[model samples]
Target: MDETTIQLLCPECTKDWQASPDDLPTPADMFHCPNCHASRRTSEFMRTDRDLQTLKQLG
Candidate 1:
């Protein structure tokens, strides 16, 4: 399996983090920041600018 890195910006603390896509939770699951410890649904993180454009085009 290939590993992908996804960058996520923290809304609560304004921190940027990089996580592995393979280890990330599915659409029905959630992800937690290893630094600030804030948690949010995986789909919610997909709302990032990088992802938004692609997802929007796909929709």
Candidate 2:
């Protein structure tokens, strides 16, 4: 089976990180960017075509 994962992007720094959805304890949980220390909800991250391509390559 394939593990479900999510990609997180920081609007402030444009940095990104990826992890399993389980890492988020709740729907309201906020993700902090390692690069910029800015935080935002997972839903707020923009999923661009490049991000989709990266996910495909990783998969």
Candidate 3:
């Protein structure tokens, strides 16, 4: 079985990280960037089909 993950990018620092969608605390909660310590809502992260494809290829 293949596990799927969501890629999150920080707009402030432009850093990327990934985690299972289920692992997120809540949709209303903010995701904190480890690199720059910037906080943003999960929906604030930039997502694109190209990013999804890249993650799929990596897995």
The global Cα lDDT (0 to 1) of model 1 is: 0.60
TM-score of 3: 0.65
lDDT of 2 by residue, 1-59 (tens): 98866666677888776766555434345656678777785455535555444444443
Model 1 reaches what TM-score against the true structure?
A: 0.57
For residues 1-59, could you state the per-residue lDDT of candidate 3 as single tens digits? Answer: 97777777878878887777666544446767779988886555536655445444543
Listed in order, each prediction's TM-score against the native is 0.57, 0.57, 0.65
Question: Which candidate ranks first by lDDT, i.e. highest?
Answer: 3
Better of 1 and 2 by TM-score: 2
Q: How does residue 48 of candidate 2 score in lDDT?
A: 59
In order, how many clashes per candidate?
Answer: 0, 0, 0
Worst 10 residues of 2 by lDDT: 50-59
Candidate models: Cα lDDT each: 0.60, 0.59, 0.65
Query: In model 3, what lDDT does residue 11 have?
Result: 84
